[model samples]
Target: MFVQPMWLVMLSWAVLFVGLASTAVVVVDQFVLGYRQPVKVMEMVWPVNALYLGPAAVLGYRKWGRPQSPRWLDRHGSPPRRSLNARTTIKACHCATHCTLGVLIATPVTYGFGLEMFGSTLWPEVVGDYVGAAAVGVAFRYYTEARTGGRRAWAVMRKFFMRDLLTVSVFEFALLGWLALMHFVFFHETLRPNGPVFWLIIQAGLIIGFFAAWPPTLLLTRRGVETELLSTPQ
Candidate 1:
């Protein structure tokens, strides 16, 4: 029997705690605060961001997560709210969140299964990351669209698939590119799928991918391929 390294174990626990804590914040905000009006995608995105960014993500949410109602009364007898473009940032954040989470899940699973199934090939990890990210991204899009009702299942799925493919691909490309550089150039060590260093690297990649995916998201929104998924406050 072999004993695990203390550092590795500590890092693993840290990752687990951060991921869980971030998820908890988003869930509570969505269900308890009744901020579930817009699309549920944001709820998912926030927690995922929190997973990587930790307290910073939570702070951002407190500052900019929900639309701000105006202090002055409007002609409609309610305060005016922020424009949809403001929330578009949140939407773009969702793209990054889903892709990052997918990759995080896929890397270790594929690494383990691939070692067992294929006996030490890198392809399994690569393929798994793409497949997982694409699957999650498409699923989230479909769920958001489906909740709107009045659309056929096949139609909703197809629309989401087409819309998400390019964006998700871009996100993965940026993320993997950075990770590859880290492993091959800077670290000069074999990549450890479950290591804490791997996760910290992934967090940096996620931030990079978020910026990379933003333009495409904005374009999609402008082209009408993507719309506001969040519900308006009643």
Candidate 2:
């Protein structure tokens, strides 16, 4: 019998609308206006980020993402080197894309099937999210390292996947905890993929997740993990 306050519900709708609009901006810029990234996966990355970050994601795409376009590289004749801060942001988002896809898939599957473990859907969702992220993370690593760099798959596993596992685990922590306490704890009955407030929680959680993961990603980048692979302009 609980109802979300009128202003809260309206705010949720407004926030979700902005996120959608932001995602559209990135899509139009990439697909329609042709500011496509040289790395095809980043086309997915940037827009997905916009789904949560709204105009801030668009701004990041404009600054860091746009310059990676082939057209820009051709005009400039070289890729401009980004600062450590910029590179760290890129690295976090690169890994975060995996987490995003994982959670998006997990949330619905758990909800739809009425799956639960340990008296909460969170446990199963966590498993699905982790497995999905690792699967995609390994695939991305294979593409970037084993296939592109010509390293052996095992070597790539040792070098990339291990580090990525740590990064993504840290990345997922805050968002997962947030959902557990704020969304699932109070509104468990109401929040679903079909609900706007669900996405509102997701949106806010991802922003928190971004901040949570940033520090470790920056440390890893400074230590020269995934540096060359992430640095490729093409």
Candidate 3:
């Protein structure tokens, strides 16, 4: 009798390789193709959909879909203020500044190094792409929040579905599916395989994805402060 390799074992190994390869590609692509504007940062939408929203939806539905307050509220006795200003801004400024600086430095380093090592320049283009995407993100967030009249980010997303499972599921699925297909199918012809175009696609997808998702990230991360303002004890 012939013995077959275990599917789980093969999948685990494949996943490990994919993770490592993807990381290396990102590092190289960000500096090389991104710097060159080979692909718009909006391209990042595909990967983020595939890697983040896709998985998050599955896990969130399975784990946190029921009616329940957040753990922080449960532990800290709800929020205290609607807006965070002054001290909070000062404290956050340092971290945000550092993060921005890191991106600036990383972009150039990756671009220069990848060019020297692999004969491609991507950093500058990616920076431009991300800038555009970030602008879009900001606009989307502001418009949605303005419409909701101060609802939290998660609340806004929930409201978009009007609390209907079919609505939320369909929308999320479509968004993710569109991104995935764009990256894998529609953009396949544009990918240069071994060339710099391949690298640019990686950066673009991430940039676009992050841009589209930034509003959610901001709201989710700052929900504590917002809740505090609304729920403060009289």
- Each model's RMSD to truth, in Å? 5.1, 2.2, 18.1
Q: Give the range of the ten consecutive residues with the poorest summed lDDT in model 1.
A: 67-76
Say which candidate scores most in TM-score: 2
Off by over 4 Å in 2: 146-153, 231-234
TM-score of each: 0.73, 0.89, 0.27
lDDT of 3 by residue, 135-207 (tens): 3333333343563385466655443333222222222233334434544466542333243333333433433
Candidate 3 — which residues are off by over 4 angstroms?
1-48, 52-57, 65-120, 148-223, 226-234
Clashes of each: 5, 0, 27
Which ten contiguous residues of candidate 3 have the minimum total lDDT?
A: 225-234
Error of 3 at 80 (Å): 21
Best candidate (score: lDDT): 2
TM-score order of candidates, best first? 2, 1, 3
Score residue 142 of candidate 2 by CA lDDT.
Answer: 68
Q: What residue pairs are clashing in model 1?
A: 37-231, 38-230, 38-231, 39-229, 39-230
Q: Is candidate 2 or candidate 3 better by lDDT?
A: 2
Positional deviation of 87 in candidate 3, in angstroms?
22
